[model samples]
Target: MFKEMKLLKPSWITALLVIVLSLLSIQNYRVLPAKEDIIFAAIHWHGPVLLTQTLLLCLIAWQVVSFRKIRFLVAIRGKDEVIQKNLLKLMTMEVIGYFILFDGSYLLTGHPIFSKGPVIIGILMLVLRMVLVWFLGLLLITTYTAPYPGLILLGVLVVNLFYHYVIEMNFLLIQYSQTYDPLWKAFNLNR
Candidate 1:
């Protein structure tokens, strides 16, 4: 089972995750606050958030990279065919997981960011992503080469950044009134 898994080298995977985790930790933090609550805030919450996002990103990235490894081009590539089929199956599971995550998080948190409407939208988007995988996988099958895998990877990274910093931050601000928030109530989303 371990050999059949075809995992990437542990070091390479760690390095990739570190890059993303570091970027996530650094973006849109200091400037977002007025006076630096840097010490207490970083000490209290940053580490946990960083760890959680790192793990989540790592899991998502693993799915992506693993799927890309399946070579789609060879007419007789049993390996590619099997891997692609497995990826499709895994993606279905992932979609269901996302829906559950969205629903559960929204219900428990009572945060606008995780509200039922957004959760439903997020679930729909997950389904859309799976559809994209099917179409993209078909393209790769016909071409036998993922000519622009980097493009898709970069796109996903950007989307993650927007979700984490922009969307999540807005939702969080609306839910919690904090001294750490910026001076302009106009800029703040607190309701």
Candidate 2:
């Protein structure tokens, strides 16, 4: 199974980029309130983020299993016709997974963990975030790869930067005020 699997350099580069950027974003979030409250906020924010990270890992596992199964079947059948179809499916899954994992990391950077919600609600939030991130990734990738689409990619990147820095920050501020601020305050004051 390991012998049959190959990782592309570009995909690895993209993954690294996503991870570094996500970490930077999370660090920015830590400073949103104050240096003294960083630990309090991190404790409050880690639970749901950890859950979502687990789900994302599960998705990657499923993709790997599916790829291995398809490869095994191809080996047993020894058919050329099916190989192309299966390989295409595998590649598509890999690309989709790459984009989802990257974008989901970005989403996790700003999202606060819910302390009192039902487990189902937390799961739903994770799913919704993943879906939204996947959609955004798809749109950006599509535009970037379209014929003579550099201009479109640039436009999309500008908008994405605006949304991330301006719109999402404001949204997070509003959300944290309603949901996370009291918990953070209590946690810090008690400590």
Model 1, span 3-66: residue lDDT tens: 5345422345544544454445444343434433322232224442345343543454455565
Q: Model 2 Cα RMSD, Å?
A: 11.4
At residue 145, what lDDT does model 2 achieve?
21
RMSD of each: 9.9, 11.4
Displacement of residue 6 (Cα, Å) in model 2 is: 11
Regions of candidate 2 where Cα sits further than 4 Å from its true position: 1-12, 32-112, 116-119, 148-151, 154-191
Q: List, residue by residue over 16-102, the lDDT tens digit for candidate 2.
A: 644544454355453444322322232344522343333433333333344444454556666434433443444345445544554
Error of 1 at 74 (Å): 7.2
Residue 33 of model 1 has an lDDT of 41
